[model samples]
Target: LLGTVLLGARRFRGGRNPQPRRAPPSPTYRERGDTTESFPLDFTAVEENMDNFMKQVKNLAQSLYPCSAQKLDYDMKLHFLENSSVTCNDGTPAGYYMKESLGSRRWLIFLEGGWYCFNKENCDSRYETMRRLMSSSKWPQTKTGTGILSPLPEENPHWWNAHMVFIPYCSSDVWSGASAKTDQSGYAFMGSLIIQEVVKDLLTKGLDKAKVLLLAGSSAGGTGVLLNVDPVADLLERRGHTTVQVRGLADSGWFLDNKQYRSTDCHDTVSCAPTDAIRRGIKYWGGVVPERCRLAHLGEEWNCFFGYRVFPSIKSPVFVVQWLFDEAQLTVDNIHLTGQPVQEGQWRYIQNLGIELRNTLKDVPAMFAPACLSHEIITRNYWIDVQVKGTSLPRALYCWDRSFYDNSRNNKAPPKGCPVHLIDSCPWPHCNPTCPTIRDQFTGQEMNVIQFLMHMGFDVQKMAQQQGMDPSKLLGMLSSGS
Candidate 1:
């Protein structure tokens, strides 16, 4: 009982449990001095007691991935690590099943969101976002017909030449600061795998490192870019490993300093997503551990980044994008009542979360563009938006000209109407994921969810173009969400 309570306490404290705050400097056991078991297994075992629950998730990853109908590769590479303080590994974990596609020109890599192992049955929200991206990208088909600001339309997507790599979120490493059931083990291990193996494979296949980029959705991607970039950049510097460009889009990103934005606390004691939406968040898309891991449930790790904050390093210029009223961030915490109007408290909760996250990261010059988008629209994060309605306006946020990026573009007009506020926008507030709004309700002509994401993505692409960077890289990670 004490063990369960302690483990539950950890789970309640950390977003993924098992990696509790207290420690004897031990990796995951309840007792800081206890080093009686393997690192990952001990930390993770309690939360993940292999009892029918995990087998189901493992079965799911295997079953869903093997639909030869999809013409996919199933087996994954594994690596083991052992050390007193093992922060870096040669890539790969001891027991992981990875997904990769061979003979494709475009590489689609999705970063894991939570510290929990990727095997969670509830993490399916990621799929909802990815499916939208792949289907909308219309790549693997023809790009010429994509309709808007499509730059690479004439270029071949080279689907045959492309190979995709899945960043696993679990590990079976040794002597590391992790337990099998702990959350850190999953995210850290998965990120290490992506950095070590996926990137390594791309270089090995003669793919230009500079051209390869990684994308993430509804997830943190563990910010491996923080660690991997410097070392990999060093490798690129020495010509040892080719440079692999990584772009991170943390959808409804939860990594910002959690104290301010970790959902409002009802009792001044505990924080939560929102009482009204927490339930709906679970039943809508099958969110498991919703209560235990959801924001409404509001555990510690769900919002803490002590590890990353403590080990701060600027790896790649990872673009951390978000939508204004994100359901995934707020709504995901609880299940919402079906027919009721969104309550005042719920509204405040959602609005505060977005503003807090946005303000926290605004001045880093890391590249930020917010639209009047909602939760996680596929097109919103991927497409580019502009003041496209009330009046004719030339693109200022992103122009082919280099001066535009240096903030030299004159504030052309008093800024034309955005068109979003004018129309019954299908996506706004919390409707689209990667939205940014200076005014609370500067309404204008509105676009559909897909339209919004495309608008946002196009802007990102334009930024890359002005900066002289490749756009197709990591199309999966950052191009979608809410």
Candidate 2:
């Protein structure tokens, strides 16, 4: 019982568990730290023993500190920026949702993800459809943080106690615009400015005393982190906050500048899309790139928008979390996935996309790149389940955090069994057992073994008919490669 409690306490205090699938043969009972006994385990006795141990611990804790029993509220509150110049696309007052943890000196500012509008037609269409993202008028007064921003300890193990800040995406500029409303566009694109203003506002609200600040974002916002992380650190340093260590966590933002399966002359179609979008949107939004990247690109500042292009210029440490087969990238490349099987050429193109992602992520010092076909991660409820080489995302993040501090203290290496750079080397999708379930968009049903085989460029229907067997029963003969 004491050994079990000690192990639990060690894990709670941030120790590596390293629970891999297979274990090597033990040398002996003494070497394994066990005292073998010949007694049958009693289910009722075990429960009673644990209950009595917990009760005793609880009583001792109360006697040691009577005031520790009181619970604290960690509900998020809405706060609008006091500055009038900082506004959204619709000219509404810019704001952010914050969940304060008075005891913690750490801060996590998360930028929400919504795709950008490149031109006036796109902005006009967005205002008509996704008004909530374009305008902050319809935003809820209060919200409960979930996923990485979750206040619950069970959901977010590492940063749950930190002060959480959720900045909604309202600028429609991929969080890089610096221009106000224009006569031609008739919408303010102050995304970069909004982030600056939020930090300035936070400085007056306990942020001045913060020790560690993690700037994180998803999708477009993730790209924003790459473009703006250094600027945030510069802002803090310029204002005399030199002690704070600023880091970035970008999720699903490592977009590749690759060619589509079918090239098209038209720029508006998915075959030739974001290339045109980035080229036009950079000027349309009056986008600002990092000084180092701007100096490097000179004539073409839009290159800074891509992760591989701008990542080299970023001095601050950042952790990239991207899917090997990103859904958004597939859609933009005109590779539409459905319930039906894909063509042979389409399968090859999809496989190349994963390879390209792996190649791009090779230099990233800290990242969790799983060979899955999904988009956003950090904000998903199942973020905990997704693993790379038996190390979950949360555990990888914990190890990365430790390594950062260890480096700051001039340590040579990270803790044993704690991996930071993890990537799925598998060649196919869903190759990792911890990969999330892939569902059909039209039917909203989980893809079964037949569909999975079909996705791998196999004509399962034809094979089943030829063998005089149902495709569903082929699971026994074939593996999903997981």
Candidate 3:
């Protein structure tokens, strides 16, 4: 059955978009604090006009260049967890998709990203929107495989031919929780068990024979990859796959140790600090901290949940892909210091985050930290185009992967320090201009309103009037480089 699936999948040829031969000029932004803050005369009229203008721009752009990636079809089949006992958050069976193709005896397992839930209210809210993800019945038979999961060798040269496993996020534990707790609210946490069962089943299906393995995840899933990569590799090695060259890649999972953000309320009205969420998750899920991390931190086991603290103890070679000014940190995480006109302190905090991140991964094999405002990168077009010092992110990653897989001990190590591909400028200059005008695949609306406002020369006062919002509130949102 596996051979037949691979043979059939080989017929589907995926094409890659040509890389931009020449780099575009670095984007320019107006000097901050240059313009005066003044409200528009008519708030309602300005709002309507701006909305209509944005709509027209989005429509025109969509007509000219629809997202070509979304149009392609790939032979990806969703398979429910074979063990009847393994289940997801609503007691539904857990599931994953496998796209088998002819290539090396390698495997690329991608853990899907969705933030975790701590309590029943959080779980219930997540369930409402993620029903399709939580249940196998609603799994899409065919998915457009793009980004790291792209089936085309031209696009994803690393593991295009290797078996691809797409594990859906349903357990809400970052795949690290073990003990199941049933409260009066009937919430169950079984992420760690689900991962164990999934790995066992994959080994039976040929993962045991894998010569190369890349365990990767984005957002919360990225956290999962970091926490579980060493254990997963150990599991495979114990199963007689010791020769497998195992590596891990975390996309946008470089969560910081900014506990201060927890005090501030997030856009969702929840605690903004990820540490707070981690603490709750640990309590409810009965998750175990990595032994090395626990030993290092002694009594502060919770510190292990932060990527900065965890990276030092990670034994395997891992690559971290993140943005210096991550959108999630600014918006969803609510790390702002002042309400309006972005105080100097807030900017300092963002810069400190970058410095801390660089210091944390100083010894890692590779890192791609672009100075951009966006969150995720591996799954977007930016993965190919975003450049630093004349080297595109994909090219840098390719070079690093080559060095990582090199078996020639005689060859000198690529470099002792982390091969960081980072952008020098602040995120405002690197923000993708097309983001504001482009229509979102899910929302079918302009994806970035702040970018649009900035591009169109709209000031904070005008923006506040147009949206019927306070100027201070708008300024705080703008401070994040939204």
Task: Name every residue pair that clashes in candidate 3.
Answer: none
Candidates in order, TM-scores: namely 0.40, 0.82, 0.70
Best by lDDT: 2
Better of 1 and 3 by lDDT: 3
Q: What C-alpha lDDT do the candidate models reach, one value each?
A: 0.33, 0.80, 0.63
Residue-level lDDT of model 3, residues 1-482, one tens digit each, is: 33333343343222123323444333442233234332222211222123233233323333333443345346668777788677777677887778764434768888887777776776677778767545555667666567778765445544445578888887777777775446664555667667667778888787776767788888877888888888887787787778877788888887776645336643232464666677666776777666788799886666876777888899888888877767666554555423233444555565566666566656655777765556777766446666665566655665666564443445555644324454444334234332213344345566465644344344667547967999988666665644
- Give model 1's TM-score versus the native structure: 0.40
Which regions of candidate 1 fall more than 4 Å away from where they truly are? 1-108, 112-191, 208-218, 222-239, 242-249, 257-312, 332-339, 366-482
lDDT of 1: 0.33
lDDT by residue (1-482, candidate 2, tens digit) is 45655455544433223233344446873475344232232212222233334334334433433333334345678899989878999899999999877557789999999888877876788899889888889889887888788865566767676789999999988899999887888999999999999999999998998888999999999999999899999999999999988999999988887887876654432445667778888898999999999999998998898898899999999999999998888887888886567888898898899999999999999999998888999988899899999899987887887886677669877788889999999766776767788777767778754466565676656656866988766455545443
Off by over 4 Å in 3: 1-73, 181-185, 259-262, 265-270, 335-352, 407-409, 413-482
| Candidate 1 local Cα displacement, residue 374, angstroms | 4.3
Q: Which stretches of candidate 2 lie above 4 Å from their native place? A: 1-74, 264-272, 448-450, 459-481
